[model samples]
Target: MSKNEKYSHESYLEYQGKYKGIWGWLFSTDHKRIGLLYLYSIAFFFVVAAILGLLIRIELIAPGPTIMDAQTYNGLFTVHGIIMIFIVVIPGLGAVFGNFFLPIMIGAKDVAFPRLNLLSWYIFILGAILAVASQFAGGGAPDTGWTFYVPYSSTSSTNVIFALTAAFILGFSSILTGINFIVTIHRLRAPGMGWFKMPLFPWSLYATAWIQVLATPIVGITLLMVIAERVLQIGFFDPALGGDPLLFQHLFWIYSHPAVYIMILPAMGVVTEIFPTFSQKPVFGYGAIVISSIAIAAVGYFVWGHHMFTTGISYWSRWFFSFLTFIVAIPSAIKVFNWISTMYGGSIDLKTPLLYAISFIFLFMIGGFTGLTLGALATNVHLHDTSFVVAHFHYIIFGGMGFAFFAGIHYWYPKMYGRMYNIKLANIAWGVLFTGFNVLYFPLFIIGIQGMPRRYFDYLEQFHTGHFISTIGAIILIIGIFMMLFNLIYYRHRGAVAPSNPWKGVTLEWQIESPPTHENFEEIPEIKTPPYLFKKES
Candidate 1:
């Protein structure tokens, strides 16, 4: 195609394709459009889930059915976990940012399966609809928690079947997206970009996609098993009904554990892309980072058993899992050290993205260390069902992945929208969000150590102080969240027009027009150096 035809003056947002208006986006095969679709949908689900979580917190503030009854609270948390885990965090980054950038970063026009990409979003929507509908579909929300632990899930009188169907369907969507990314990375990388020559974001997604494809089937089967047991009177999880509970745990966690990586790996990729760009330095230990990404994925698969340490697992099994758990920690630590070293002597820019990246390291360290604590057999026994697990989880998911999501959005907002959000406001919102995040979860670690169990709507008088403080923090967090989101939303059209390469990023996306053309590249660019060559840019 000629340069003018290939690099249209109109952006993807403006390109009038075979369809017009909303239909243009609905049936569109464009990867960017699909990414935005996922973005909008995920954002809505996130708000719903977050509000559910906040209501749960409100109920816990005074310890005695403050705002909601026990059954209502159980239903709230159950739906909250299902929405946050399945709809929000699981597909948050990879589906939104991954769909948007993976092909562009790899120097391709779109995914290996553009049609399938659009279909994945459709599946995602259908599954999300089912998940939410479980709340009001005449039976009330499923109270099995997001994990849907077997006996309770299989026999629960609530809407367990609807939730199970939703989870199963969502897993299918995840598998398809993963397959699409894997094939795209393997086949469509720009000419001259070898395996080692590819950027870290795609590498991260490459590993994540493998985990998604290889591991998701386990959960899909497990969810199906639960649904079958519920509807067909089969015995799969309930011990009284000829099923083993521990077996259920194993099967559920096998996928759920790797699913953690699916949630966080791309976050890692987003920051990996950010560190070098903000520091104006080539990524430190590129080969090490690359290997660690793959290593984490490979090692992540075997560590699922750690989640089952407390379930009367054999002595040898506990030790084996504990050892592998620590083994998995190695690569993550390498990434941390590599990230810090990348900034050690480099000209670091404390922009919005970097601020979030730096905060991620701090929070992830807390979460990672706490995770290792949970991995220990003795501590696992102590904290497995305690509030500490809740604290540690939020730190990792909200603090690590959520902040990284914000950072990626701030970093790429210019390129994605062709406009610049107010930087001062962005910085202010980041500070508020970070502070609110800590205040919200840090107290749980203390209260958990003090013996407060998770999923409880009420607590003893001794734990009352911590819960109260955490509630206040939740309110603050909501404020900060609204502020950050408002800044981005309001600026979509009113913000200053952004330059093509605002951050002066060395990647090919930076070399292209803002809000990249319908086809990402005008002509496929040949890569001849490391992806983050700051010296060349300087």
Candidate 2:
């Protein structure tokens, strides 16, 4: 049989199309295909943002301007932050893996609304275009930072309107995706599959989706208010017109703070899945992990004030937010301990995915602990707007979420593409990336304590040594990233075909055919027990 004929009988990949070539993919409503669509687009923007980050590091290597002037540097900063936060990390795991695997894992044919899922991707792209277009079409690139703090955001000559519009639209896309996931999980589980029996990945998504649906609207409304301030001279955020800038900060953090959980929760879910599968054992404290996810989401909302401790808020409010912030960390710590306990006596497989998972725990621990310093009013007063804050943010987002993303890609790459990446190359790439990552960000902790403010194009001579070392780390990190990307691309065609259950996972997804059939299952699977139940073969 021809490839098309063979796929026609089995997987979505082989489905014949009315529109040949690119058009088919563009219009595809297949959850797997839509997931790949997100993967490709997100990867492209990730590279763009990474390159911009490297440029910033290179310029900072010395005390003076090395590559571009200050204005150009500021533009790059705004664009980089916008792309990484809104485009890459926020939707990273859910849009790619969740869309592809959630239905299969739950024994459903597809998402509750496949068309809306696809529409979300298009809206994301449109938001990205408007954000980038602002740099070229309007007065100049937006320089108010990703937060778009006012009265600077309102009074700035650059295309603040475009930036605001892009963020507003992107919020809509996020909200829609959240709605889709919530409905799917609630309504689509297989026969005998109860809420507790569901896999950790979907459980994580369940928590994340709630945050996305609830918290995103606050930021959306805030961004719209910003546009109003710019275009209609609304006195909402602009102090010049009887508006309170502090109010903008409050509204923005109310969303953005919970938004951090939106980025990391799915990643935690990814780790949860990888642990039991690679260890060849059941997850440790599955209930605790699930409950912690809900706790993080619930408590995440009340801690936004921690970000504004230095904004002259009430002393009681400051301490209250700090208490909530510390409280949120308890559930996260519970998860870490459980993961380690899961691997204690099990048959641990040191695969690439497992390696990335281990790294995530290490890096995320650092990110979490450092965040406590920022939560405290005394330390935050010293570290506010400093490079220490920048380092902490990246550790959580890049070190934590970014590594988990790598873990998920490697863990599920075979299932997604029916091919294996070279294990040796993957290990080598992880070593270099891990080493470079620490060298790149660790020194910022020292310099930040010494009072080096972030977002400056130039720095005092005392900070030059740290910047130089960090710059070198960036170079090394980039090299590792390129090598990893090259291996994935090259092996896509040349690697050996992967088996249906390469890691010997017990999830419903592992029970299906690799790259799964168009409708996922000929008949829906009936769950006999909770997920991650391992069986020995004769």
Candidate 3:
């Protein structure tokens, strides 16, 4: 038995019976339960956000505020983006998967700071509650974009301050989780596990955690300034208060650009895991992929200026920002190349996880390539703030992050729940989603090329056709999402019983029993080789 398990009480072994009902779930702090708490909570928010997304798409189908007024539509997209990014996607991967699997993957008893990990979950819950409360609080919803760009955002009629405050609190939770992971990795590896011997997903979390610790605080402080400007009327971002709005952009993007890294690094980790297991080989160039993750995280922060090129920032600064933006793409492209190369000659298995990984590669490629176009100062002058920007970000955020999040969930579901979902149904869901995704975003490229600004509830005659096609695609996309969620969650109790290593994956997590016991391992397993070194004999 593990050392911690030896000391743990009999009550610890009875995790399932700790509380008789929902209250048990609300208060439980076992990492697995906390992970499931995140799973259900984040998934709930995702459904809410999807409804808002569908609403936005529906209104755009025929254009000119078909279902609601302009202000209502503005509130819809704002809340949708805010809730999805802050409440769902930000916490979805790292907190949900990392909290549950990181310790188990590395052969540890618990996170270095277990109670603090619990506290972080509570803080996240509080932040999520505050975000939801903004809808019913003073103003209907914050009309400010997720970025919360200032001066205009500061002076908006909506409850911008409350929403920004909620976001800041969430950033605290994210930073703490990152710190816990970094310390745990430093102190808690199993007997023979070296840096290279660690699994790629946790390594990705390690890199992502550093970005969280370092970059999240910048945005936190920036949001604080926004709240101060609103409440105390301090003019840090206000020209009338003798502050430059441009400075706000500078500070915001410092965190916000790296914040994109916060969003995608975990997803990269997901793809990294899927490619190796499904390919049935050691990950090709594991060291290169690791270096590329760090490179992307480090370089990600310098590229935020590309978002400011057309905002009247200096031309010299614009050129510098543009250069860095293009430079950041190199590391990301390297990751994609490595993933494809890993699958090149291996025995490919097209399971649900592999399907998501394949989609991630395609969608992220489109998102990345389009980003290059927007990064060039000359090209951005034409595309800035258009539907093009909308399409580009969704491709990265929704397409890239969304697909990878699914990959992780499907990849880890058997281990976490001790059940296997219906494979044919899961693949059908993926097929629908794949078609729906391209149909939905591809037309935005058309409307953007023809000039339709985003965040406008109303638009011109020229943009309607493409908008309609995109809206129909959005409906298809939502259907696919619902089917996917149902299969994953509903099938848990009804699904087939799973084996520990159903997919023949080589990771340490697969070596343990499904729905792992209170004590994660039978014993602390030694790692004599690096992760993903598949053995043919087994």
Poorly placed runs, candidate 3 (over 4 Å): 1-24
Model 3 lDDT on a 0 to 1 scale: 0.87
TM-score of each: 0.98, 0.97, 0.96
Candidates 2 and 3 compared by TM-score, better number: 2
Query: Model 3: per-residue lDDT, tens digit, 256-342?
Result: 888788889999998898998998988988898889889998888788888888779887899888998888898898899899999
Off by over 4 Å in 2: 1-9, 536-538
Q: Clashes in model 3: which pairs?
A: none
Lowest summed lDDT across 10 adjacent residues in model 2 is found at 1-10
lDDT (Cα, 0-100) at 6 in candidate 3:
22
Clashing pairs in 1: none
Model 1 lDDT tens row, 1-538: 2212222379999999999999999989999999999999999999999999889888888868788788888899999999999999999899999999999998999999999999999999999999999998877888989999988888788998999999999998999999999999999999999999899999999999999999999999988988887778788888777888888899999999999999889999999999998888889999999999999999999998888887898999899989999999999999999999999888888889999989999999999999999999988988988999999999999888898899899999989988888889989988888888888899999999989999987789999999999988898888888898999999887787777888868887898898899998989999888788887554
- Per-residue C-alpha lDDT of model 2 across residues 1-538, encoded as one tens digit per residue: 1222221235677676676678788888888998999999999989988999999999999999899999989988998999899989998998898899989989999999988998999999999888878777768888988989999999989888998899999898899999999999999999999999999999999999999999999999999998888888889989898899999999999999999999999999999999999999899999999999999999998999998998999999998999999999999999999999989898999999999999999999999999999998899999999999999999999998999999999999888877788999999999999989999999999899999999999999999999999999999999989988998888776777777899999999888777788788999989879897888521
Residue 263 of model 1 has an lDDT of 84
Q: CA RMSD for every model?
A: 3.0, 2.2, 3.9
- Candidate 3, residue 123: the lDDT equals 90
Error of 3 at 65 (Å): 2.3
Global Cα lDDT for candidate 1: 0.91
lDDT of the candidates, in the order given: 0.91, 0.91, 0.87
What candidate 1 gets wrong by more than 4 Å, as runs, is: 1-8, 536-538
